[model samples]
Target: MSDAQNTESPASENPLSAWSGRTDGDAPEHLRWHQVVRVAEDAAHNDADRAGTALIGFASDEGVRRNHGRVGASAGPAALRGALSSLALLEGTGALVDAGDVAVRLGDDETPGDLEDGQAELGRHISGLLDEHRLVVVLGGGHETAYASYLGLAGSGRVGPNTRVGILNLDAHFDLREAPLPSSGTPFLQIARDEAAAGRTFSYAVVGVSEANNTRVLFDTARELGVRWMTDETCQTADVTNVRRFVRDFVQDVDVLYLTIDLDVLPASVAPGVSAPAGFGVPYEVIHACVSEATESGKLALADAVELNPGLDVDGRTAKAAARLIHTIVSRHRAG
Candidate 1:
C-alpha cells in the first residue's frame, strides 16, 4: 500500500510511542537506556520545555526504485528503531524525541512526481525542527534523503551566502549521476547545482569513495563541483589521524555541518544489507572515530543514516551497525 493510505504506520500513528522495548531490571537506575526514553507525540511538543536532540525517520524507497537499486529500504526506519530501542544512553538522555517519519505516498492521481513531493515534505519538517534549536538525526530510506536534508538546511533561513554549510557524506559512491530523473545517485549533484543557482558555497566532502564504483564522468563531476573526498584505498586505521586532521580542517571552513552516512560505505561483511555492498569499504572504527571527532567539533548541526535494506540484512547486522553510528553521533552531540 502507498504510504498515504497506510497512515496507520509509525509515520502518522503515535510517532513518539511507536517503538518501545522492555527496560531491563538489571540495568542500573541512572544508567537506564533508550527503552525508557521520553518521547513526544508531535513536533510542537518536542523539546517545548528544553533544547535537545530529536530523532526523525524517513521511510521511502521511490528514489531507490529510480536508481534501480534495492527495494526494501522502506523498512529501514522501523528496523533502526528496534535496534536503538534497547541501547544504553551514555549521556544527554533528557530531551530525545522520536518524531516518527515523513512517509511518502503516491496519490492515485499523482504522477511519479511523488518523489519530489516527499522530499519537499521532508525539507519542511527538518526546517521546522532546526528552527526550534533541535539537533535532528534523520533515519533515512535512501541516499536521496540528502537532497531533502540539504533543502532543510537551506530552507531553515539560518544560513546565508557568507556562512556556508558543510556537508560530510560517508558513502561508497560519489552519487553524482546526471539522470533524467532524481535517484539515489544524484542528490549531491542536485545540491551543488542548487547552491550554484543560489550563489552559495557547496562545501561537500565524501569519505570512503570506491574508485571502482564511480565512473570517470562522476569523478569529473566531483572535480567540477570542487568536492573533497578520500578514497577507500587510503581510509585505513593508520590513516585515521590524518583523516581526523582533514575533517577538522573541513569543519573549520564552514559555519554548520550536516553528516550523512550511507550504510554501503562499510565493508560488505559489516554492512551487507545495502543496495550495493562494498568489497573493501572503510572500517567502522575509522568512520566512527571521524564522525565522533566531527561531532565533537561542535559544528555538527544535523545528521542522518541511510541505505539500510532490512530484507537483505543478515542477522540484523546492518541495522545494529547503523544504530551504533547513530548512537555515537547523538552521544557526542550531547557531549559537545
Candidate 2:
C-alpha cells in the first residue's frame, strides 16, 4: 500500500499540541518539574536561551511503508511525549521546548507521494533550531528521520567540502539500501551520496549490527564505504570497555556529531514495539553506556530515537526505553 493509504487524515494538519499531563503531588509548595518546562509556542526557541533543548517530532512512516516494514511508527512522537511527561527534571535536564511534529501529507492523484518533502521540512526546522543554538532532540516516525536530521545538520551551514560531519548510528541494520525510492533502510546511503556530491566526507559508524538481520551485500556496503561498526556480538557488558573505546574515538574525530538510535538495536525483551524487532539485539545497558559516553564528549550536535511502533508495543516498554535514552542524552548534553 502507498503511504497515502496509511493515514486517516491529511498530512498538513498540525498533529501537535501544548503538552499537558499528570500533576498529582503531595504538596503544592513542593517544586514540580512541568512548571518550568515549555510547550508549543511558549517553548519556541530564541537566542536568549542558548543552553536549552528543543523537541521536534517527525511524524511520518511513509518511508517505513515504502521499505515494506510495519506501519504505526508515526504514532511515536505522541508516545514519547506521553512517556516523558511525568519524569523528574534531573540536574542538567536544561530548559526544554516542544516544537511539535512534521507529519505526512496524504497525496491525491494530482500530487505524487513525497516523503522527501516532509523530510526537507524537518530539516528546515532542525536548521532553524540549531541556528538558535539550542540542542535538538528529535522524536521519530521511522529510521528515515535520519536523513532529515542529517539535512538539519548540514542546514546549519557547518559542513563544507574540506570539512566532515560524523554520524554515529546505533542500529541492528546498516540501512544503506540502494533503492529507487527513499525509505527507512536507505537514509544513510542517501546521506553518503549527498555528502559526496557536496564534496564533503561522510564519516559514519554503526553500533549493534545483527548478522542475522543484514544481508552479505549490506556488510559489503559497510566495508566498501569504510564504515566502522561494532557487531551485536561485541556490544556486551563484558565488551563495554572496547565499546567505549570505539565510541570515544568516533566522538573525538567529528567537528559535529549526529547521533541516531534505531530502537530495534535494543534486545527484543526491552523493545518489541518496532517494525523489525531484533531476536538477539544489543543490551540496553550497553547501548546506554555508549550513548552516555558520546553525549558526555560534548560534541553531539543532535540526536533522535527512532522506530517505536506503539501498535505492537507490549506494556509500553519500548516507548519507555526510548524515552529513557532521550532523557539520558538530553540531560547529559545539558550537563556538559
Candidate 3:
C-alpha cells in the first residue's frame, strides 16, 4: 500500500483518467519552474527528513461565492505547479513536493450545489494533507481553501504556549460574508465559530480588501474578534521600508502564520486572472519584502498562496508572478 512500490490507484487505471488529460501545454517558458513541472503520477509522500516544504495545488472551481464564473481560477493549482516545479531554488537543496490537485466536481454552467460539493470535498482532502506537511503552498481554487486550510491545522492541535496561528489574507473581498446557510463564501465564518466551540482561539488578519468590497458588517465582526489587518490601500501607499518593519513587528512571536493571497488583490494589469480584481494593491515587491522580513522574525509554520485563475490569465502573467513568490519563500528557507 505504501507509495514505495509506486502502484497506481484503481482510479488511475480507468480509461477516463487517460482520456481526459491536461490540455494546458502552453506553460510559461520564461520562468525556470514551469519548464520542469512534472505530472506527478504519485501523490507526493516525502520522508520527514527529506521534507523541505510542500506545495499542494488544490484545484477546485466550484463554489457558491459571489462571483464564480467571473474568475476562472480552478486551474490555479496546475498552472502554478508548472512554475514551481521548474525552479532550482538555492541550488536544488530544497525538498519540494507537488501534492496533486484535490479533485472537485465543477457543476454545469449554472448550479449552486456543485460549488458546495467542491468546497466540501476540498475541505476534507486538505484537512488530511495538513497532518503531514510543515509548510503548505496552496494554489488558488478559491478562498474557501483558506478556512479549510485553517480548520485542518486548527482541528487537531490544542493551543499551547508553542501553538499559535496568524492569518494574512490578500484579496479584494473580505471573505467574511456570512455563510449563506452553507456554501463556499462562509468557510472562514464557520471555521471561526467551530474553533470557538472547540475551546480554541484563531487569530486572523487580512490584507488587500477595501471598504467598498467588504461590508462594514464583516469588519465589525473581525474587529470585535481582535483580528487585525492592513488594507490593500494601506499596503500600497506605505513605503516598503516601513511596511517591512510593520509586518516583521506584527508577527513577532507567531509560531504558525498562515498567509493567504487572493489573486484579486493584484492589479488586473499584472494579474488579470482573478475572480475579484481590485483597483489598488500592494506591489508584489512589498509582499516579497514582508515574507523575507518574516523569515528573519521567527517560525513561519504554514502559508498558502490562493486564488489565481489560469482560465482567465493573460499570457500566463499571474502564474509566473505567483511562482516567483513561491521561489522567494523557498529560497529564503531552502538550503543551498
Query: What's the number of clashes in each of the models?
Result: 0, 0, 6
lDDT tens digits, residue span 287-323, model 3: 7776676554545555666777777788988888887
Judging by TM-score against the true structure, name the best candidate.
1
Q: Could you give me the TM-score of model 3 versus the true structure?
A: 0.78
| Candidate 3: regions farther than 4 A off | 1-50, 64-71, 108-111, 114-131, 156-162, 181-184, 334-336
Give one digit per residue, the lDDT tens place, for model 2 in 72-163.
89899889877877666666566776667778653333553578878887887788777655588889989989999999989785555676
Better TM-score candidate (1, 3): 1
**In candidate 1, what are the lDDT values of residues 1-336, reduced to their tens digit?**
125334333344555455667665655554434554444344345444236677778887878888888677778888898888777777564557766777765222235536787787778767877776547888878888889889988888567767678999988899999998887899999999898888888899989999999999999999998999999888888899877887888889988899999999999999999988999999988899778877888888789999999999999999999999888877667423
The pairs that clash in candidate 1 are none
Query: How do the candidates rank by TM-score, highest first?
Result: 1, 2, 3
RMSD, candidate 1, Å: 3.2
Error of 1 at 220 (Å): 0.4
After TM-score superposition, what is the CA distance of residue 266 in candidate 2 from its true location, in Å?
0.6
Query: How well does candidate 1 match the true structure in TM-score terms?
Result: 0.91
At residue 298, give the lDDT of candidate 1.
Answer: 80
Q: Report the Cα lDDT for candidate 2.
A: 0.81
